[model samples]
Target chain A: MKPQSLLVPALVAAIALLVMTDPAMAYLDPGSGSYFFQLLLGAVLGCSFALKIYWRNLVSFGRRLFSKSRANRPSEQQDGPE
Target chain B: MTGINEVKGSFRDPAGRMFRRDGVLYRGIAPQGLDDYSMLMSSGLYEELCAAGKLIPHEEAASPQAPTDELRFIRPREIPFISYPYEWCFEQMRAAALLTLDVQQAALARGMCLKDASAYNVQFVGPRCVFIDTLSFARRQANVPWAAYGQFCRHFLAPLALMSMRDARLAALLRTHLDGVPLDLAAKLLPKRSRLKMGLLSHLHMHAYFVKKFSSGGAAASSKNTRTLPRNALEALVQSLRSAVLSLKSDESSGEWTDYYDNTSYDAAAMDQKIRIVADYLSSKAPAVVWDIGANTGRFSQVACEAGAYTVAFDIDHQAVQRNYLDALRSGRGNLLPLVCDATNPSPPLGWALAERDSLTARGPADAVLALALVHHLAIANNIPLESICDFFGDICRSALIIEFVPKDDPQVVRMLSMRADIFDSYTPERFESVFSRRFAIERSQRVGDGPRSIYLMTKR
Candidate 1:
């Protein structure tokens, strides 16, 4: 996938981290570290969702091409006299 | 995800739209909605209701700039948390229903009325019921039918009647019937004797009858002329409904899991020792939150809370949770919150797409967990393996386990084993330690007096 698609999810993860890791708290435990990693994993998973949308558009484009061919191949069969 | 953006519940009157952006929640009040909103606010009703804690307090939009296409935003006071009706127990729902009527009476005095009566509009702030939907108010039609009557019956009356007569467990029926349970179905499930009571006969039993009878025959099609009731009569009807609803009482007894503390095999010496062990463990680990699983009336949660830890006193028994919650409220205990939870099947993630709300597990991995008298049920009754149970706990918390291991000869385990085949071949104290030692280090363990049960304070490795 392109880097462009990954940008939104990466930003979301960074924002989530920033909100959670504010200066007021004590030292981070293993659990918080695990959760931070989970955020990044969530971003990677989010990229697949974006890819699926693009894939669907590509499939629809191919289907349109096939349908156009079929329409052209069946030309003038229903032409009517005046 | 769903209904988060779309306007739902009582807010339907104002073009059915309310939303929260960033942290600010807002409602759209159209020009048509303004008259009712103005009357509700200006007629001293808003102040009266807000003071009584009947309505959620809201301030005017911070800026004089009206909401428009270019910059459509109006900030209203935000609710801290939004709880669902299904999560509410019987008393909570009852309180909300009463509060709704109280608000209605206040609105009526101001020459306005509530356009909706959806239970979803109510949320609990501490122990009090506060109305969350500010846009539900509308100008009272002087001689017209109660606009929210049918909704009130479906949302509050039906569920309350069911809980009052059948079983308190029937309160969970709200999860299935999101729009509120059908009144007709409620009437049928209710005992035949319930129909004998005047309130039940009129509100639920006869109310269902008329609704079905009229709808089936399309009686409204026969006449274009509208039937209207006077404003005073409408107020009277509201009062009567309130009185009727309040009269319904739960015939269901306390939850079956009572007497857990009494039935425990611990003597006074052992109990004191166990409490001391837990208190010491708390001092060392110093967790902010503690979940006392199987915490019957919060005997142990109190110990943790006193140690400066916020305790969630969790128990399967409804009565235990009710008592715990009431005690916390009465004592003004800010650090303790009691919740009814079944360990085998805990509170699932509810609401739209299941992501909008957190489940018991999603909400937790508590700072620590107190599993006293809880392991046996998971082992004997539920047929869960000890290793699996240990792993589940390990996944949920960082450190500390205040747990008890009841031997096979223990009365509770014996009873659980009596009805079933003796399939638990490994249900021994030695085996319990060995299995748990795989994931948790046994920090401390002491057999409680002459009793076969042993309380262990284990730290997750």
Candidate 2:
């Protein structure tokens, strides 16, 4: 049998183990502490992802601010896509 | 303050609803949504996305129709054509996915997140997928798993993976399931080998597992009621999803209709003459908007555009539409839009109340329509009768139509007949003329390439 094909049982066991070892001693439901932790993790991860995405934009913005050649830019007669 | 017209498709996002007044589209920000809309407006993310041509830009409407009720009313730039995901080729769907991910990443950077990821919120303006829903953004919260992650997967990823792995026509599943194809369905339909692929395995297979386990009531919250996904993990998840989406390369162009142009009997000179003739007909009655049906690779769409008509190139083959879109990008032409559509079962009026999305004909009464080298396929292959075909064409175009008829002995038609028994006894040039002439006044007729086949330009009677 392929090792990859064994993940179904492995995953089921992992879930079973997590349920058995629950430290909270109560059914926490959807709003449980661990779920909150995951959400928090997601938010922080989102912040970092955003930062990584805008790094190039930040550098370009900095370059434009520092460059003398960018001093005189024409104002838009209309607002639209450049 | 009297007129109150809903934009029809904007009811989902409670933050703001798209409305219309005096024929102009306006977004009315609700009280609950005002704070987030205000945050987005001040954040400069909107300006940046617009500057990059990634987001559709809007302005405060000069005068509000409902001034007292609205917090901040603005008018959005009108999208020339609104096309749904089902109508998109594989490449277009892929492009929409990339754009959504980029928007999400950008939104996160600006301390905002996409509240939802619906392919319906996107509209194509000249080869670029621009997000149109102004209220899709909300202030980002700490430790929240991407709320729209599941939606993003369904709307963009599921259909894409299904299209790439299972069958290209499976993309049409978006049309039937207005909320996007369900994960369980996609997971089941995907091949056994797909389980080995990491991205597909985790996002699709594992995702389906969780959905079934938690949802099915058999295992009632197996582990914790909820699970924690850390920042790094969430990023990894998004990245993984992106990789899964990007990995699917469309292998569409080699379909049945793809090689139709190659097998054509028309020589270069004949092709040029046909284009000139079509262009001349288009110029005589310069249509405001033109629809080129069976526009394989959009060769005739370019002719319409060159002759100064905004063109919507509709082709059944995804690869052909993809190529047409790429050509539009390379040529920097704003007038042409390529869409995948099987003329017989063209995209129907779909979504809530059947009006959320416009049907193929709902977007039309095109000022002019070009139905070139398409009749034989509809008549012979698909078995649509000629009179019904004429009536369908009649329903879509108002001013003019340029259609071609390939004769029974023509190689393409003969090839179509070679497989099936010839039931079409009335498939004569004379019969064709008489049937169409009932609905359309023949403006002009010319035989293309010394063949029995002919092209006719008609005015709807």
Give the winner by DockQ.
2
Give per-residue CA lDDT, model 1, range B280-312, as digits (tens): 877878988787888888888998988888787
Q: Per-residue CA lDDT of candidate 1, range A22-49, in tens?
A: 1211111112221222233233333444
Runs of candidate 1 with Cα error greater than 4 angstroms are: A1-82, B1-43, B57-84, B139-144, B221-225, B252-254, B280-290, B304-312, B325-337, B350-358, B362-367, B387-402, B407-411, B425-461
Candidate 1 chain B least-lDDT 10 residues: B220-229
lDDT of the structure predicted as candidate 2 = 0.77
Docking class of predicted structure 2: incorrect
Taking the tens digit of each residue's C-alpha lDDT, what string does model 2 give over A1-82?
6433433433332232223221222111222222333343344444545455456456766787877444543333233445
Tens digits of per-residue lDDT for model 2 on B330-366?
8998889999999988888877898798899988899
What is model 2's C-alpha RMSD? Answer: 12.6
lDDT of 1: 0.68
- Alpha-carbon error at B237 in model 2, in Å? 2.9
lDDT, candidate 1, at B241: 74
How much is the lDDT of residue B238 in candidate 1?
A: 72
Question: Best candidate, lDDT-wise?
Answer: 2
